[model samples]
Target: MTAHQLLGSDRHRDLRVRAERGAALGDAVMTSLVVPAEFRRVQDEYPILFRMNQERTDFVALALFGFENGENLFLKGDRWDARYRPLALAIQPFLIGHAAPDSDVRQVHVDTASPRISGDGEGIRVFDGDGRPTPYLEEVAELLGELDAGYRESAAFFAALRQHNLLEPFTLEIELDDGSINRLVGYHAIDEQKLAALGPDALGALHGEGHLMPIFMAVASLGRIAELVARKNQRNADG
Candidate 1:
């Protein structure tokens, strides 16, 4: 259902991408993949949690937006309520592509099938009349690069958490004003007790590896869980 092609000025000169937020453009979601690099900004708006991938071998960080599938509480009308969006979500419809399997070089690839692909002249242009990347494309490139680096750095970060037993299972129960209960399960969060009980040597090791700040940031982000509940309550009350 996706047609990923290497983005080229010659091939996609007139191609435009919609930058607005909406469910039709695939913005509807309960959680978004997040990287530690953006944890500071994400923590300020959304709770950061960890979930096992399909293979259940490694953990991936997520920025929680709602409690149910296809429900994004931060989505207010056509605009995202948060000031900062996770790079993973911001780099939608575009991804880093390699020229070859073994090649270190990266190229930008676009999903031609994405609803964000504009048919009319109603969105941001990828290339200018001079057949060069527009400022929007330039920004997309930067976001892609940062997301790529963050994904790579996350391997070591997750390994450190596993080695130190800093991740633990988490379950959340939310009660809306209408007294309906929502239970969220099958997620893991930073184990504050384990983190605090670590010996100085272990703590120093984590700090030296540059994994300490993000760990705390993930913990701090739990406060936003209450925010999500409030948003959910407001949505229900409005209805």
Candidate 2:
């Protein structure tokens, strides 16, 4: 089934709720702890920051270090790689926290009943409902790993919000490379007046202090921030 079909009925309901509430949690943490840390580090390392794009799923912050090739890097939320599974799983609880308890939400379970290497002898494969080899098994494994690692942290944060009854309404959309999108999860409406009172600068400072290192490290591993920007600009111009 396609990703949308795979979402099933319950998943769709969860998506709707997340689209309305997830952003408050994401925005609060990111603006307060993630962005400022990144800004400080980038500023110290590079002479200038050319463009910084922060959306719910698409987060691209870049800096320009005037080396021979110039240096650039970006952090992204969506990836097909297995390495990100832990992160995805970590975020799942928060996504589902606002889900209706009686919703037909079912955990995905893989049957490792029989595993075999592919015909190409290059990788292992597993059979699904029909006896066909599921593609991207390796990628799935990596995602699982990321999910395992990330779940606890996400749960803790989500729990705190629930305890304080501060769960805010927000939305989250995952834009894939195939031009299709998925609404992952959400929460309740937040106190806008209080959030607004924090102001942008204060929020920025918080992000810089708390989340900069992890975000910076993730992007740097993906690509050179400077190069990515240059390539993006080139693509826009050509288009």
Candidate 3:
């Protein structure tokens, strides 16, 4: 179904409106959840250029979704950056994904876009000059298929978070290739003390065990409540 369709119902529209207005923490989480699906859609419909940003090598995935309106959506995530900024931009699609040399990295360019694929000392690169490429129709279609599958699996996890009302307040800290660090903070609430107790090694172990996301989601939910209470107290004092 189309995005508009997914967001067409009154309940979904209400959530969307609240999210657009920055009303609820859950809204932000839902927004993050929808972005990968949208990116998958773009990968299916248009030519996407993929390359590695070696300077910021921590990013696990990045994609630019160009629309007909001269706008683009930049979606990126890193294992270190706790914040999931989906729909992060409205620019051209310049997508990248971090893959180990042994990992499978895929790119797809549409026939209408001028597509070129090359390899550098670092990794494989794909470019679409006119934003159209006709030669790799089958390849592009397969890439989209894979992304769609990934989206579905990820969405299931996102949906669970939403159901638990634990979407915002978690943050991601990423260490890039340059040794600089970036943090992405979520709107969901969290307990700094509890998170600190977990420590980096415990957190890493949890992530390795596939429990990190859920745990982070729970922390973020609590953190959001803490923030709200603090803000309310500040407002009361001002009054």
Candidate 4:
């Protein structure tokens, strides 16, 4: 159902993408993959959590949006009720692709099946009449570049966390105002006790590796969990 194509000016000269926020545009998600580079902004709005991939080979960070699947409490009509959206979510319909598995070259790929792909000249144009990329396309390209670099940085960060044994399994339990219980499992969080127990050598190693700030940011992000619950309660009340 995904029709990905290498974005080219000549082939997609008239291509337009709707830059709107809504479930119809694939914005209704409970979590978005985040990287350490965006942790400062993400922690301010969303709780940063960690989860292992389906293969259980690597750990990926996530910005939590809701407690349930496909439930984005931040969705208020067509607007996302947050100042910062995780890059993984913000870079919709566009993804970084490689020329080959062994190639370092990156290319922009567009999902042609996305609802954001406009056919009636109802959205932002990718290329102008001169075949040059529009401002929006340029911005998207920059975002993709950042995302690509962030992914590489994230792999190193996760490896460091594993090396230090700083991640621990976590389960979140939420009780709504209406007395309904919700549980979030299969996730991990920074082990504060273990972090505090680290000696000067380990601390220095983490700081030297440029991961200390983001680790603290991820820890600080847990405070946003309460805010997330409040949003869910408000959503229920509205309904």
Candidate 5:
């Protein structure tokens, strides 16, 4: 059974994390979160696209890893081959949760089923013998703080995208080396035409809100698709 409990020095003091990377640790995915705060870092390593939520009320930026489902081409021998790891994938089994059902107080929780976590003393200790958090735990706290802030920033960033009509549904046509053509649908990206048509006042509003740079960054990120295609071809050839 999967359970998430509040971290405590007494209860989780002996816990350790093996810290594996890639699919073995559940990193296999076609897309994951891309925070506006990390847009510059993500654009160089992966293709950035936007996808509508299931409710269709909003969109979320995604860092595309592969052309197909369950295909993270960035994974190589259980190691991620990227300089900057997306915050959504960098931290696993750890999240900030409320202390109570209606409480506003945030606390850290972990997924007990995660393979990265252990009680066999094989990974970084959760706490020191004096019942204080270890450096690993401290780092986890910092990561959670950053991830939380990034997502909050995204809420406003995506809202701005929607308000400006800057997003459009997109489809990707992929032709693999093995003589198969595939199409990816149901995602969105910046509509350059609409963006260009915006009046100066509107553009100034976006710029003042700190959305201009990330917008151009996301647009420029389309170039990374060539790199992804090349990697896919290499993987196919190696098989």
Candidate 6:
């Protein structure tokens, strides 16, 4: 079970967070959920796709990191090889959440059980001795604020996609060098043919509403599938 606590100076003044990546610290993953606000940068680094949320009410935009679950091809040794790491990964061990109804501000919470947390200066400090936010904590607050705003924007973006009947599901099959096949089923990506078929009026609406860029970025990201394939092959060859 996860033991997440509301991060505060009073109770966690001794808190230290390590801003590093390691497979032993649960860094392995197939994908990270992304937001429309980051589509431009994220598309350049990973294949962008949409997965059905557990509730099936909204589609989650994802940056593909590996062909299968519990694996991340971008992670080599203790470092992430890609030039860009998704915001979702950068904000690990800390999450933005609400504390109660009628609360107007989002609060930051930490998973105390996370392997990254230490008391002996193993990581970033949450607060100084005077119970004040440190530079690192301030940056986290800003990032969390941006993430919250992005989520709100994404809700509207998904609504627009559904309104245009553009959401569709497809399967992807990956062949590894070791003669095993990895097939991803039930995931969805934007349909380019249908997108191109949109009427000028509809296209204009997407453009006017700032949705066209993300749509194109999502489609352009498909080109990165080959890059991921190469990484998987290299990993296999090295083994």
Candidate number with greatest TM-score? 4
Residue by residue across 103-184, what tens digits does model 5's lDDT show? 8788999887887787677877878999998887888888888888888788889888989899998899988888777677
lDDT of 4 by residue, 108-169 (tens): 99999999999888999999999999999999989898989999888889999999999999
TM-score-based ranking, best first?
4, 1, 6, 5, 2, 3
Clashes of each: 0, 36, 31, 0, 0, 1
Candidate 3 lDDT by residue in tens digits, 92-127: 021223244465663321221211111122212122
TM-score of each: 0.98, 0.26, 0.25, 0.98, 0.94, 0.95
* CA lDDT of every candidate: 0.94, 0.32, 0.32, 0.93, 0.85, 0.88
lDDT tens per residue, model 6, 50-136: 988999888999999988888899999799888888888787688887778678678999889888787577878889999999999
Best by lDDT: 1
Task: Please list all clashing residue pairs in model 6, or write none if there are none.
Answer: 17-123
Tens-place lDDT per residue, model 2, 1-239, is: 11212323233222211111222213111111122223434343332221222444322222332122211122122221112112232232222221345755433333212122122333332333444334433345444444444443333433332343433443435333445443423322333455445657745753554442333343343243344345434434554
Model 1, 1-239: lDDT tens per residue?
89999999999999999999998899999999999988999999999999999898999999999999999998987999989999988988899999999998999999999999999899999999989999999999999999999998999999999999999999998788999999899999999999989999999999999999999999999999988999999999989
Off by over 4 Å in 3: 1-135, 169-239
Q: Which regions of candidate 4 are displaced past 4 Å?
A: none
Pitting candidate 1 against candidate 6, the one with the higher lDDT is 1
lDDT score at residue 35, model 3, on the 0-100 scale: 30
Which residue runs of candidate 6 sit more than 4 Å off their true CA positions? none
Q: After superposition, how far is residue 151 of candidate 3 from its true place, in Å?
A: 1.8
- Evaluate model 5: give its lDDT: 0.85
User: Which structure is stronger by lDDT: 2 or 3?
Assistant: 3
Q: What does each candidate score in C-alpha RMSD?
A: 0.9, 15.3, 18.3, 0.8, 1.6, 1.4
